[model samples]
Target chain A: MVNKSISEINNRIKDGSVNVVTAEEMVGIVAELGAQGAAREVDVVTTGTFGAMCSSGVFLNFGHAEPPIKMQKVWLNDVEAYTGVAAVDAYIGATQVSETLGMEYGGAHVIEDLIRGNTIDVHAISPGTDCYPRKILDTTLDINDLNQAIMLNPRNAYQKYNAATNSTSQKLYTYMGSLMPNYGNVTYSGAGVLSPLSNDPEYRTIGTGTRIFLGGTQGYIVGQGTQHSSKSGFGTLMLQGDLKEMDAEFVRASTFTGYGVSLYVGMGIPIPILDEKVALATAVSDADIITQVMDYGIPTRDRPVVRGVTYEELRSGSIEIKGREVTTSSLSSFKRSRQIAGILKDWISHGEFFLSQPAERLPSDTVSKPMKQTRGTAMVRDIMAKDVMTIHKNASVFDAAKMIMDVSFNHLPVVTENNILVGIITAWDISKAVAQNTFDLVENIMTRKVITATDTEQVTIAARRLEQHGVSAMPVVDEQHHVIGIITSDDISMLFARRN
Target chain B: MKIRIIINRDIVTKPILAEAIIETGIPLNIAQAHFDSTTGEIIADIEDTEYRMIKNALVSRGAEVLRLDTPINWDEEECVECGGCISVCPTKVFSMDEEWNLKVDTTKCIQCGTCIEMCPHDALSLDV
Candidate 1:
């Protein structure tokens, strides 16, 4: 076995003889050759993961449109893309839900479309200026037309991620994947010790400016990831790079049905065997990385802690949560992770890629508040029911009654043709009318004047309205006078459930 | 261009691929393949002109040519473009344009169909 230096590895990389193995494969080498022998023989260990990373996005300069508008408003396929930058530049966030499709589509889909080299419909309405006269430019877009497409993510590759489950009776649609009610299922995001940042707990060789395989392209670590808690069970890092180098497949957009848009970031890291210590770091397996399984149904940053459990427990297909052994599945792919590790290993061995020394070490001094709760940013919009079951003006009285009994809901907002909140009927009102045998047209029994709330209103406003009206639920309207959602008492109760 | 074909359970014992080559003059390049008594899904490439000939030959040999609406099922309605499929895509069929819209190239696709596993949207799937 030879103790190959970085220079020697680079030299071998040039000559196409660099000895590389995936972190999965390296475990076997150490078992056969021993840690010291394997450390001397191997130059690099590649690690990877493909999972839903919400903190991912792209910055694109669309160049100048014909008679360019200083586009204030931007939408890619009806999903809002941020136009806060210069006129031609837009930052397409991965989580921005489509105006048309709502949470079903978003900016992550926009990024995927761009990478696929498909034409994107770029529609922008601007408050026109003399310098930039166009008020609206409806145009088709091709990725090549952009001046710059930067993949600048504030966070990715969580060192250790939580396995989320539900304790409450209601199912939670979250970025944590779908948390079934009554602990029916758990969705764990961590690749366990196979997780990139978790393997390098101290961030020795993997750090800022480190070349990494990101979304099928070479990307670098830019800075500290948000909520980067080194004090927590694992170390996290933030990264950025050019989107141009990536394929459309690696950086994908996904909508978790009701949960909204999220990006599946494909990432790979090369751990150079600097010494036996470094080799040992790569040896850390699923059994070593202890992570938490939080109750997503608990609804707060400081969600109800189920218990600390190892990734081995996580991967066992079920976890013991609050004395109940609940089943668990992965949002992150095990197959893709192994595939990425293999790809990196081949790239190093065939001299197609070379590892570079990170320009800076990952900062250890960074403060990550364990209580960094995002409760302050919680808006009425986030909690509002986007899809409310409404009784159509023409629907029969039995149907309305059944809707209430089926869901045990108190209020039913009656909607007109354009989804206008025409009137509201309560289960209490229905019982009174039915006792009187006045079960004819709903308008005859339903309240003609309905107190309503708009989707843009604050939680305080909705809460105030509910108190003032002494109502269990209020219809939430949008600008088009559409009944977009209903603010129910049960929905408001969720705020308090997570407050502790 | 590449297309996928399913094998009948009865034909699981038959060398259908070999028969396809013998019966049809066209050459088939199997990029990705999976076979079992329950199912035989193969993604194979052939010249455009040979599509009908290959279909007829395979059909005669107890094979079902899976006619896809588009073998690459990309639903723009649900796609979030998070790039889960990019890393595992063997053909690089999926990518993002300048506008960040996920675009698909059926031409480059060998129809490996790995995107179905990684899509959080449940938006992508091959007809096969």
Candidate 2:
């Protein structure tokens, strides 16, 4: 039995303020009051998770200075910042490592420093210009000094992340955290009932533009996360939020020792108990949310799933794998997750927080690509460079030349101020410009008409297109036509290697 | 019949191996030796009975001994050098070199399985 419309809840929320219950309390409510009664009483169920996600990053719009350089190259406290957006605006990626400190310090650290009200060493070098004269500038910048600081993450809070274990006889260092040898210890990321997407299960309420509590402030989901998948029944989303409102405690950077850097983002999503189903989904216990155990020792796209286990068994500190008791730990801190959820619950119960209908629903049909398959065809995403290093159209010739020389990459995906794929510049293009003494601006020399491949399209099709166009690489766009990745001839050669 | 021994300054400054051989009248060969100011480690080959006799003599002389089947080998392809083995190893067997790379002292390792359990990647094992 279900009875409660979203409008009725919103109307009550508007002025007729009603009481609220937490995701944890809702568990007790349904057990006692039943789903119908619980749904009628609690307007919304607050869910949260604080986890390390490398795909997370902060976008900063630095207000133009007296003599602002295009800022072709930018670094904050020695950590490289992607200045491929607007002239002054930059994006600090969580995984982007520091030049001097290596992987020990990264963009995530810079964001944390900014949030902590600490001034960071800002360094930028640009070729001399007429309109924008400042070429070399070194200064200190705090988060408050920036015009806008927004948290726009590509992926966060994986709904059913795998539990990590090592199957090989030796120990391996991976981004999944330190896995003890021979299934010595297991580590899982999902916080079960405390996870936001786990509570939703279905994307009925939490979707695009759904307002959420992000790091102690209000934020909304912009669109689907890069690896949005449910195939097993759930909705995952990439989220965006204003950085100026977030708390420093909830937004921090962590270097995973041997692994790369990741951001510890605190997110609280409210699930409106519109019906009994929503209430039931919100009541899911740790035992209900099942995830697979994966052995990273066998390094392959098709990493073997040792077995399926639940958060309950994982949180218990040990699980049986291959008839041996292996110690279990968590990569995502559940204590932090519960703390965030408790904060959200307090806000909702106090009528300080309100739930908003999603501006747009996240597509539930987005399926994850299967790992094992007979060799025949492969998607562009399978071979494309997902972590692409891009060059802004406004970048200087010197900057472009330096980048091309540094990485020794031929093709540079030229992005506009809005991060939209405009065109590309090749080594030949740069060489030709340099030979003629015309390599001044990327926007001036970059080819505007760009040939691109969609993520889902077959690699063979992309290969044929590349051959027809006589290009070495092609940009891979998503359904939204955003340049998500780049496919190169080197990546496609693997398709041939698969034959042997 | 092959083993490695870690000796303190008291045993290190003395010709302990030669003394042990002469005392036991056991035919032994010193395969390799590494010595420093206060400590030393030596690899030697002998008969099984003689090896045990040497072990007793070394321990009696305040020397730490480790039996070895073969030298321990590192699988480089499988190792990312996380340095998990350095702490668990009691003999200071596994250490990070100047470049922070996991370096194994074959002579010092006792095959205690502590490092094997500590290593997340299965990279170290006795070659034998």
Candidate 3:
């Protein structure tokens, strides 16, 4: 049963004599008890993760005909490779498949398939949709003199939807240019070339006239434009722009594929670890319960030993039983001897020998002994204190202080009308609230959450709760939200001291 | 004279009694018993030659004999056919039966709870 009063359990626990058994110990105890005529009622307690993972692994291993898409191998081709559009489409398609399958979503795979494809007209293709085409020159152009230029003109840059896929397409242009110049081995001429007028319409003046020619200008300019074209053409006519369209499709598909693969492998593994932790926690709890039951005593039947001689044998002065010789000559007082003989007679009559003392007892003063100490089987109601103080959600600060002073408690439980524990109003909390004047109502000043303990819990558990919450006191309550007792730090200290 | 008493089992009041005897300063006779050994039986029967000294030593040590003489019998037929009691018994008084039921190798059963709890037929009982 859940201990409602945290303080009381904590007190017993602090005394250092509470029985806290782990799972392995419980198993031994259960076996021992079963041997001693008691039925084992071992119940396994755990969080859900262990079972979940076992189920998941089983399902993954056996449920599917083929390996799940997450583990499936996908391949990408050249057009999909160049613009990376194919990867993106594959990613989106995989997401759709995952949603349709009702299985946990895993990502897609993107493999860069480098295949040979011909370069097409740049003006007809879409940006980021068509693969970037290369212009392979048969001969290297003069590095100093070549001026390369590219121009693109598209009918539209923004088209929301097309009948082909009902997906929007955004067009954009990018321009890149570079220049290289070479100037070397120059000679200046001044005589005939600079002559004043010999059949030349223009003649150079005589004073230091010189002519010079400069060479070598090399650069390239790149530009692009996109037009929004809805595929209204049918059959053969549609084949006209298939190359550019396919290039665009590959770019989108490639992007989706890469994204899908990443989501499946990288993000899915950690999600299941949380479930594993839950299972571990449950196993530990079961072990603890088993240990507790085993430590309790097991019952056994009686075995009686007898040592006696009949009256006739005594009179004859000779007796023997089980190959042991009997000597009865030391009887100084006949009556006393008869009394001793009579006691032996009784043991023999019952067909059992009774040993007057216990054969073995555990050492009373050892650490292990204390650890195995059992708290009597008393329910929480047996130890719970009924006098409890509670505060409402909207109570005022003054009202809270008055309640605290009246009850002489360091902390007060604050519950809603429905009896749920919404918060706690400790003296420290109240003092802070009052000092700041930041909140007018108790709800504003009160701690919105508080750790609680049940009535049926052991004092050891209560002490642990206290330590875990780092609180000096906690309120004990029943199922119906009624406060039963208040356990304090001092109570735990006294309980621990007394137990020692 | 100083004397030491070695008990075969963990006795609760032995140390207190020992201290009391030491303060009295009486001639002591020491008897030692191996409690933690395989056979946890007390071998307190000192030889007649050393009886006087042993008696004096026990008195000096404040060793009170709680039980001096008691007749113990083992019922062979009533013995349950289980061997668990043998394991926990300090004195090796009981042994297992090779042929029939749980036979008491009276030489081995120290009468510990091990066998008593182990017997499923409710057979083994202690004559205390």
- Clashes per candidate, residues 3 or more apart or on different chains: 39, 10, 76
Per-residue lDDT of candidate 1, residues B19-84 (tens digit): 889878678988888876588888888887888999988988888886443667788655545444
Model 3 C-alpha lDDT per residue in residues A1-500, reported as the tens digit of each score:
21112233223334532222222233354345441221112211101000000000000011111211221222221112112222111111212223222211221111101001322111112232123232221211111111211111111111111100001121101000000011100111101111111101111110011110000011011111122122211000000011111111111111111122111000000000012222122122211211000100111111122232222232222234235432211111122212222332233223232111112221222221113446663334444455777888888888899999998887888878866677889889878886887657888888775666677876666776689678887778778756667777677677668767
Cα shift from native, residue B46, model 1 (Å): 44
Model 2, A1-500: lDDT tens digits are 66677677767766747666667777888888887888777778888887677888888887876787888888889988888886888888988998998976788888878887889888888885887788888888788889999989988877778878898666656676667577766767766877888888778887888888887788888878886877655456788888877876677676665677878788888888888888888887888888899988765576899999988897665689999877665656565677778887777666677777887877778787766766567778777888776789899978888888987878888887667887788888888899999959988899888888888787877897788678889888766657788899888897779766
Better of 2 and 3 by TM-score: 2
Better of 1 and 2 by DockQ: 1
- Candidate 1: misplaced stretches above 4 Å? A1-4, A322-324, A370-500, B1-119, B123-128
Task: Write down the TM-score of every candidate.
Answer: 0.64, 0.63, 0.22
lDDT of 1 at B39: 84
- What is the C-alpha lDDT profile of model 1 across A1-500, one tens digit per residue? 34556677788889876788888777778878778988888888899987888888889888786786898998889988788888888888899988888876788888888888888888899999989998998888778878888988888888878777788776556676556678877767756656888767778787777888888988888867887777664556687877877875567777775567888888989888888777878887888888887877654457877788887887665677667767666677666677778788888888888788887788765657655555575566778787678888777677788999987768888988888878988888889878988776666678877777776666776786688678778888877778888888778888868776
* Weakest lDDT window of 10 consecutive positions for candidate 2 chain A: A327-336
Ordering by DockQ: 1, 2, 3
iRMS of each prediction in angstroms?
A: 9.9, 10.9, 49.4
Candidate 2, residue B72: Cα displacement in angstroms equals 29
Chain B TM, cand. 1: 0.74
